[model samples]
Structures are given as structure tokens and as C-alpha cells.
Target chain A: MAINLKIENKAVVEKIAKLEEHLHLQALKGFFAEVADMTMFTLRFFKEALKPRYEFKELIKQAYLIGYKSFPLIAITGLIMGLVLTIQSRPTLAEFGAESWLPAMVAVSIVREIGPVITALIFAGKVGSGIGAELASMKVTEQIDAMEVSGINPFKYLVVTRIAAATFMLPVLVIASDAISMYGAYIGVNLKGDVTFHLFFLEVFDKLSFSDVFPALIKTVFFGFAVGLIGCFKGYNADKGTEGVGKSANAAVVYGSLMVFVIDMIAVQVTSLFS
Target chain B: MKKTTGNKVKLGIFVSASVILLITGIYFIGQRQQLFNNTFTISGIFKDINGLEVGNNVRFAGINVGVVEDIQQVTDSTVKVDMVIRDETRKFMKKNAKAIIGSDGLMGNQIVTIIPGPAGKAQVVDNDIIATAKTVSMDEILTKIKVTADNAAIITTDLAAVIDNIHAGKGTIGKLLMDSSMAGTVNDAMVNIKQAAGGLNQNMTAASHNFLLRGYFKKKEKKAQDKADEEKKASEKDKK
Candidate 1:
């Protein structure tokens, strides 16, 4: 008869525990490594951006593509967002007999938080994924290598132009979105209430100060930069396959959206500290 | 090429519109802060600012004529608030104008109200320190209310004790309110007063008609008749 010792069981449990601890440490290390790589990539891009042989035509084309092309989508989403927010907030405000405060309330919320965050998320979803996938495909098909061989910097041509376009376009998009959203809110207010456009805007502006607007707007620039940089960084360093293209796109969106919130949290804290 | 040019025009219009909107917003907000206007600075040193801050509206009379520009701690007990008043309102503001931190409403922003000084006083100059009146802060109001409420609570406790004594017939008010015997005594006094008043009226009438007083009344009547007769004779001689 063979005697069965439970030696494998004890060792297996210990090994599993050790593996978990190691995985946790590895995860932490990987996170730091990823951050370091992104930072270096961004620094390199900035260095490249400042150098001569600027891609002005490409930058303009990218702006046209990113900012002008994204208008319809941003506009529709903004309108819907404003309308929905108004409809939802009505009952609560009406309960307090502060329906008169609708425009100002909605204005503050949209300008200070909702407009920037929503626009950034949309930009991440649209431009972020586009940059990631486009660049990743270029890498996979060796177009980047061809460009590099032909006395052209792939980073400068693609990353710099795209990032610059995104950074500049996002504010434009936010401004348009904010205006459209306010119009939508005005429509929403008129649905159940009677408020003239001038009065509505007046009330909207009366409560809003510089503190509520500039910092909120300033953070959107960083948000755009983060999204563009992450997208470029992820795509440029993609793994050697079609699967990597998908991974790049996914990571760009995930990371871009995540960075928006993180930056927003920091912005809020800093704004509050000053304000 | 034509299509690209058209797209460029569209982009330009879009960018221009956005910039205009943004600039307009900035201008409005800046205007509220008294940034882009002809303004003069006036300040007030206050024992307490009562939660007044930079950008709080400064009202003259009932209208907003300026905005608070800065708040500085001059001493541990004093705060200096600098206000930028609109240039147009400078003539109306006198040297003796007072600044007081007050609220817009029961539940509204704290505003600095500039009480215009008496007419004929020199106009307020730029950077002139206006007189500051102490504001009753919410905390002080609450404290006073708390003291009042405590006093009211103590008084009510004493009142309740006094009322209890009245109910138990332990004091004068208690006896008057609660003692049936005291009520009976009051009723008996009232009855005795009524009876005494009737007797007094009869005695007064009997005294007025007594023989001892009749001679004096007759003498007064005879003197009245003689004086009337002399007056009639003098009138007849004048008529003759």
C-alpha cells in the first residue's frame, strides 16, 4: 500500500500565497514602469515638437479632422446632456421652489464640471481610439519604419501633430459644447417655465464668477494633452501584431478617460485651495 | 482644393465663434470683478469683516456701485477691505461714507454697503479709507439668541413655579386665583359697598334739607331778589 502524504498541499498553498504577493509587487512595478515610459515618451515628443521641420500642414489637417469633424457629435451630445440634466434636476429644484434658479444652476454645473468632463470623454472615445488604432496600424504595417528610413521622424510627423491638434481643438470643442448646452438648457427651462433668453443668460452669468470658469477650462487643456499623449504613446510602443492594435486602442481610451478623472480630481483640489 | 478651402472657412468660423463666446464670458466675469472699467479704490478698516471677501458686491444706497477688491488683516483685531467703486458713483460718495458688511437677503451673499455721508462733505478720494461700522455677525446673533433663549427658559421655569403656587393657593395671586374663600370675601365686600353707598345717598339728601341749612338758603334767595329789582329799576330809568 502507498501512503499518501499531504506534502504537496502545504507547499502548494504557500507557493500560491507567495505568487500572489509577487504578482502584487509586479503589478506595482509595472504601473510605475508604464508611467515612467509614458512620461519619457511625452518628453521626447515635446522635444521633437519644439525642433524644426514642423508639420504645419499635417497639424492643420488634424485640427480640421479632430475639431471641425467632431462638431456634430459634440453638439448633439451636449444638447441632450443639457436637456436631460434639466429634466432630471427639475423635480428636485421645484420641490425647493427654486425653479427660477434653473439657468444659473445648470450653467454653473455645465461650465464648471459637466461640459469639460463630458467633452474630454467624448474626445477620448473618438480621437483617442482613432489615434491609437491609426498609429498602431501604421506601426504594424511598417509605415512608421518607412517614414523613419526616408529622413522623416515618425514621432514628429504623427504624434506631435495629433497631440497639438487635440490640445488646441478640445477647448474649441468645449466652448461650442458649452454654448449649445446652454441653449439646450434654455429650451429645457422654457418647456415647463417661461424665461427669456437674455434673462436666462443674465441669471446664468450673475452667479458665475471667474473662479468657476477659468480653472475648469484650463484643466480641459491638460485633459486633451493627456488623452493625445497616452494615445500616441500606447500606439507608438504597441506589440508586434494585429492584437496589439486592438490593445493599443483599448488602452488609449481606458487610460485617457482615467486620466481625465484623475486630472479633474487634482484640478478640483487645487482650485478649492486657491478659491 | 475648393472643398479644403471651404472646410478651412468653416473651421475658421467655428474657431472664431468659440473664441468670441469665451472672450465674452471672460469679459462679463471680469466686469463683475471690476477688472475692465474706470474704477477708484476706497477702503475700510473694520473690526470684523463678517465673512466679506474679495468680489463681494459693494452697494451704495440700494444699488451696487462697486466691488470689494482686497481683504487684508491689518491687525489681529482689525481687517482692511479695499473696494473699487465705479467712477460714476465717486461724486455721490462723501468723505464720511461708512462701510458696513451686510447681507443681500436673509439667505444671500454678504455685501459691503457704503452708507453715503451727509451732503456738502468732500467727495471720497481714491484710496481713501472710509469709516467702517461693526457688523453683527451671525455667530453673535446666534449667541445673543442663545442667551435670550436661556433666559427665557429660566423665566419660564420661574413662571411655571409661580403658576403652580397660584394653583396651590400659596401667594396673593394664588389666593386671588385659586382660593374660593378669597373670592367669597371679595363678593361680600362688594355687597357691603353697595349697601353703604345707598345709605350714604339717603343721609346726604336728609342733610341738605335740614332746618339748620334752610335759613342760609332763604337769606341767599332774598339777596338774589333785591339785586334783580335794582337791575329792573336802573333799566327803566335808562328807557325813560
Candidate 2:
């Protein structure tokens, strides 16, 4: 009986090992499958987007909802970002007796990196989740299905408009955000010491160049596209039921934010190459 | 329909504002680069640029009048810098003006500072090759400082040794300051000089009282009295 029990125990351990291996294999398969699906989805968007019967009205509406409605939050965050960064950086620069470099340094930091990345992340959180949840709920309620049955091109009307709006609007929002941030930085500079508005702007423009502004502006378009694409992809491919809506929204934010950093890293590398 | 049109108008306004801001920013940056302004080009040859790159500001008499447009190595030992100066400031920049590679601040980008020459010289024409002046770089300044510091260190070391010798009563100054025996010797010499002076005074008095020297002394006194009377008469004449 003791011999039998030992054999059974060995069998059980072997079974568990096999199960673990299978689970790992399943996870690997899932990852690759998701990658393939996402690629196909992206290709489909490009195909449908370039076709005739452009969704101009829907595109404008999406731009209004996504870009204009999101401005106040972006503006407030931008102001705080610029102010806090300047305030925190002042002591260190002051230690070096380089407090006068505050405007130029802050301008470069905001225009080159901070302004685009922060704005993209905020856009991802607000608009990415909104797109994801809205589409996901529509999918769950079979509204998307009804639209398809009604002979309407739901993907063209729904996804193309959003992706296009996000692509174009983000650059504009970033420009506005950068401007506000500079103003905030000016305020921060004058908080402890006196720097005239004219001098502050002069210092800012003095350090800035086409290389700094153009690359930053160009990258925002990509950042916007990524956020919108990820959100729409998540929502459109959501699973059945109300729970899918929440999951889609959550995943949209996680993946959208991740893509922003990824794209930023690539953009920096590319910019450095040219510069 | 009305609500949709209103939304479109808001979107249009937002986009327009953003585009305007972007254009304004671009204009300012471009203006700084002398892109929009009427500009004239000038070149200078220098031994070393000291990290002056293209697009660095060119200042004429403390004012940013232009930008460095191009930098090329003419030879191994010389660099050619091209500057795009505003056409408006061309009159102020003379043909004899000298361009020196300077810096914005202690820790700032290198710039080309144009020093105006004698006032009567003609204005600098476009494509004029201006004279370049060699300015002291930070490395050169640091090297001089290092030499000075080394000399200072050596001097201080010698001073410390001299002080040590004074403390030990070795040299003349050291002995004068630190040796008690030398102080005593100096004190004794001073006393001897004082006694000799007193003896000399007595001898002088004795000589003046002698018959042979009395006439001489009397004559000297009379002469002194006559001189005093003459001075008194001159003063009375002056007062009258």
C-alpha cells in the first residue's frame, strides 16, 4: 500500500507540471494572436479610411467632442506641470547661480518632451476610455449589429471618424497646451524674482528652433492616433455582456498610455538621428 | 441641425485659435533666425571657433543683430564662420569691424560679437570678409589661473618657511625679531650713540668759548643779527 501511494504522488506531480507547461503555452499563443488581430484591425482602418464617401460630418463632431471638450482639463494640467516643474527646478539652478536660464531651460523641456507626452497621456485617459466604453456598450447592446444589418458601414462611420479626429486634433491641443504652459512658467519665474513678460518670451523663443517645435508637433499626431486606435480597437473587439465594456475601457487606458511612452521613445531616437 | 452647426462652429474656432498660436510661435522663432528680415551675409576666419556652431546669435555692440548661418573648417588651423546680419544694422557694422567668438554668459553658447571699428570707416557690404579676433577661451583662462595658483602656492610655501625661520631666530630679520641677545646689543649701541652726541655738544660749546674762536662766534652772531634786521626791514617795507 505504501508503494502504491508513492506512485500516485509521482503521477500527480507529473500532471501538475504538464498543466503548468500548457498554461504557459496558452499565454504565449494568446499574446501572438492578439498581436496579429491588432495588426489586421489597423490595416482595416487604413483601408476603410482611404476609401470614398468620407465621413466629414462625423469627423468634425468627433473633433469637437474629443479635442474641444478635453481642452479645459489639458490646459489646467499643463499650467500646473509648467509651474511645478519651474518651482522645483529653481532651487537647483539657483544653487549654480543660473536662475536666469530658467525660461530657456523650461521652454526646451516643455516643447521637446513634457508637453506632448503629458498631453497624450491625459488624452488617452479621457478620450481613449470614453471611446472604448462607448463603443463597447454599443457592441454589447447589439446596436452595432443593428447598424450593420441596416446596410450602414458602421466601421467607416464610427472608427474612421474618431481615428482621424484624434490624429488631427491632438497636435492643435498640444500647441495650445505648450503655450499655456509657457505662460505658467513665466508666472512661476516671477513668483520669487521679477522677470518681465517680454523678457520671458524672448528667452523662450531665443532657445526654441524649428527642430524643437516641428518634431514635437509631428509626434503628437502619432500619439493621438495611437490613443484613438487602441481605444477603438479594444471597444470594437470587446467580448459579450456589460462587463466587457468596463474591461475594454480599462485596457484601453493601460495600453493607450503604454503606447504613448513607446512612441515617444521612438520619436526621440528618430529626432536625435536627424538633429 | 442647429446644435450640430453650433458644435461645428466651436470646433472651427478652437482649431483656428490653435493654428494661429502655432503660426505665431513659428514666426517668432523664424524672426530670431533672420528668416523674415532683410539680411546680409558676412564671413570671418578664426583660428579656433571654441564650439561656436551654426545658428548662434551674432551680436553687434551688445545687441543681437544677426545669426551665425554657416561654419566650415577652412584649414586644420582655421574656421570660417558666416553670419546673416539684419540689413538695417549694416550701416552700424563697418568694413573694419572685428568679430570675436564670445559667450552669452559664463555657462552659455558661444556667439560672434562684432566690435565696431573707428567711426569714419565705410559700412560693411554684403559678403564682406571681416577680421576675426582671438578671444581667451575658458580652457586658456583656467590654465592661467592654474599657473597663478601654482605661483601663489610656491610663494605661500616660501612665506611659511620665512616665518618658520623668524620663529627659529635664523636670518637677520629673524634675529632682530626673535633673538633677545640681538635686542640687547641694539639697545646698547643706541645708548653709546646718545652719549657720543652729548660729548660732541660739550666740545662744540668749549670751542666756541675759546679766545681764538670767540671772534668767529661773535662775527657769526653779528651776521645773524644783521640778517634778522634786514629781514625785519624787508617785512616793514612790505607791510608799509
Candidate 3:
């Protein structure tokens, strides 16, 4: 009886170890698979983005939805960001008797770093979640498959237009955001110190150069592309259920925001290298 | 469908506004760099640029009219700075214009200050090498200040010594300023002079009253009264 019990116990331990190994292998496999899938998706996006048969109407529609719809939110966030940044930065600058440096300082801060990063995060949260959930629902209801069966080229029509719209519109939005943020900064400046609109703008522009503007503007395009691509990828491959839609939406925001910071880091490095 | 159409119109407006803003911003920045307008390149060779870099503003008469486009070291003692100034400003920039490296503010970037020369001189043309003045560097000014301060310190020390000497009644000035006995002697001399002057006045009055000088004294008094009456009449006329 002892020998029989020992054999069973040893077999159970082996089985448990085997199961753990299998789970680890599966996780590792899933990670690489996802990476490979994303790479393929990105490659396909490039292919479709340049194809001859352009989806002009769809592009316009997506632009309307993505760019116009999101402007108010972006503008509000930008205003608050500039206002808060100026108010918070006042005491430190006032200590140095450099209160006049407020407009230029805030302009540099917003144009170079804060504006792009914050706007991209907001874009990720709203647009990324929207894209992810929409695609995921279409996936769960078999709409994507139906489109594929009907020879609709669903990826080109849906993913391409959204991605292109994001890529095109984000820079425009960032420019608008920067302008609005400057206005907010002006208000913030006048809250404590009086600055004419012309003088404030002059101060802002005096500090800004091509280096500050171009690199940041270029990065926003990449940021938008990354957010849209990840959102679309996650949603398109989402598991067929209500839970999958929720998961896709969550992952879209998470990964999109994460990539924005990551891209920002890389952009800063590149900019520093050139500068 | 109607909602989509309205959204499209809104998007168009937003996009158009954004594009306009972006273009305006770029134009302003480009204008600052002398990029959009027709510009002429002029070079200036300086002993030192004083940290002035390419893309730094070049100010003419305290107004930014151009930018430092290129900075190159030609020799150990000479640095060549190329400036791109607006063509519109060319008419005003004479051939004798000078360039000097200056700071934007107390703690701001180094900028090139273009000093306009005599108005009668020929205008500066494209690729013209303008004159450059050696700027008095901050270190040089600090050195001068240090020398002045050192001299001031020495002078103050000498002044303190002289003051001490005056307090001790060592020199002539010291005796005059600090010697109590000398002050008393001077006071007695002043008193004697005052008494002598009073006695001299009494003697002169007595002498003038003599018959031989009485006419002269009376004539002088009459002349003085006439002058006073003329002045009073002139003053009354002026006041009226």
C-alpha cells in the first residue's frame, strides 16, 4: 500500500510540473504570436495605405468623426493643461524675478513636450477605445467575416481609412491644441500679470524655433498612427464575445497610451541627437 | 445621413481653421528667420563671436531685421558670420554697417547686433563683407571694474589715513581742522580785524565830515539817491 501511494504521489507531482511548463510555454508562444500578428498588421496597413483604389468618402467620413468630434475634448484638455502649467510654474519663476519669461517658458513646454503627449493620451482614450469597441463588436457579430465574404476588402475600407484619418488629423489637432493652449496660457499670464495679446504671442514665438515645432509635429503623426493601428489590431483580432469587446477597448487605451509615451521617448532622443 | 453631412461641414471648418493657424504660425516664424521674404546675405568677420550661433537674431538699431545664418572660424583670430537680412532693409544698411556680438538680455542667448553706419554711405549689397567691431566682452568689463574697485579701495585707505592725521593735528589741514588752540588764535585774529574795521569806519566818517570833503560826500549821496529813484521808477514801470 505504501509503494502504491508513493507511485501515485510522484505521478501527481510530475503532472503538476508538466502542466506549469505547458502554461508558461503557452504564454511565451502567445506573446511572440501577438508580436508577429501586429507586425503583419502594420505591414498590411502600409500596403493598403498606398493602394490605387482610394476610399475618399470613407476617409472623409472617418476624418469627420475622428478629427471634428474629438476637437472639443482636445481643446478643453489643452486649455486646462496650459492654464494649470502656467499657474503652477509661477512661484518658481517669480523667485528668480523672471515672471516675464512665463509666456516663452510655457510655449516651449507645451509645444515640445506636454501638448503632444497629453493630446495623444486623450486621443488614445477616446478614439482608441471607440475604434477598438466598434471593430470588436463588428467582429463578434460576424460582420467583418460577412464583409470579407462579399468581397468588400474590410481592412482597406475600415482600418485604412481610420488609420489614415488619425495620421492626417492628429498634427492638425495638435496645432489647434497648441494655439488654444497659448490662449489659455495668455489668460493664465494675465491672471497675475498683464500681457497684451501681441506681446504674449511675440514672447511665445521668440522662444520657439523650427526645432521645437517640427520634431513635435512629426511625432504626433506617428503617435496617431500607432494609436489607431493598435486599436484596430486589437479589436479586429478580439475574441468573439461581449467580454472580447470590453477587453479590446481596455487594451486599446492601455497600449495606445503606453506607445505614445514610448514614441515620445524615442522622439526626444532623436531630436536631441539632431540638436 | 444628414448628421453625417453636418459633421462633414463642421470638420471642414475645423480643419480649415487649423490649417490657417498653422500657416500663420509658420509664416511668422519664417519671417523671423528671414525665410519667406527676399533676403540678401552679408558676411562679417569678427575676432570672436562670443557664443553667437547660427540662427541667432541679428538686430539693426535694436530691431530684429535678420538672422545669423552661418558661423565659421576662418582663422585663429577671425570668425566669419553670415547674415541673411530682408531685402527691404537693404536700402537702410550702409556699406559701413558694423556687426558686434551682443547678448539678448542679462541671461539670454547671444545675438548679433548690426550697427548702421553713416546714412550717406553706399548700401550693403549681397555677399558684401561688412565691418565688424570688437565687442567689449563681459570679462573685460569685469576686469576694468576690478581695477576701478582696487583703486577706490586704495584711495579710501589714503583718505582714511588723511582723516586720521587731521584728527591727530599732524598736517597744516589737520591743524586747521582739528587744533583747538589754532582755532582760538584764529578767533582772536578775527576779533581784532573786526575792531580795526570799526575804528577805520569811524575815522573815515570823521574825515568825510571835514569841510574839504563835505561837498564830495554830499555829491556822492545825491548821485546815489538819483540812481535809487531811477531804479524805483523803472521797477514801477515794469510792474505796470
Question: Which residue runs does candidate 1 get wrong by more than 4 Å?
Answer: A1-5, A14-29, A87-100, B169-240
Candidate 3 lDDT by residue in tens digits, B1-240: 898788888988999999999888887877777778899999999997888888988899888888889989999898899999889899889999998898988878899889988778998889999998888999999999999999999999999999999889999999998889999999999999999999999999998989999999999999999999999999999999
Candidates 1 and 3 compared by lDDT, better number: 3
| Higher-lDDT candidate of 1 and 2 | 2
What are the per-residue Cα lDDT tens digits for candidate 2 across A139-248? 99999999999998989999989989999999999999999999999999999999999999999999999999999999999999999999999999999999999999
Model 3: interface root-mean-square deviation in Å: 1.1
Q: Tell how far residue B23 is off in model 1, in angstroms.
A: 1.6
Clashes of each: 0, 0, 0
lDDT of each: 0.91, 0.96, 0.93
**Native contacts recovered by model 3:** 0.71
**TM-scores, all models, native as reference:** 0.82, 0.88, 0.77
Best by DockQ: 2
* Runs of candidate 2 exceeding 4 Å displacement: A1-21, A86-100, A189-199, B183-240
- The count of backbone overlaps in candidate 1 is 0
For candidate 2, please provide the TM-score of chain A on its own: 0.98
Model 3 lDDT tens row, A142-240: 999999999999999999999999888889899999999999999999999989999999888877888888999999999999999999999999997
For model 3, what TM-score does chain A reach? 0.94
Candidate 1 chain A has its poorest 10 consecutive residues by lDDT at: A1-10
Clashing pairs in 3: none
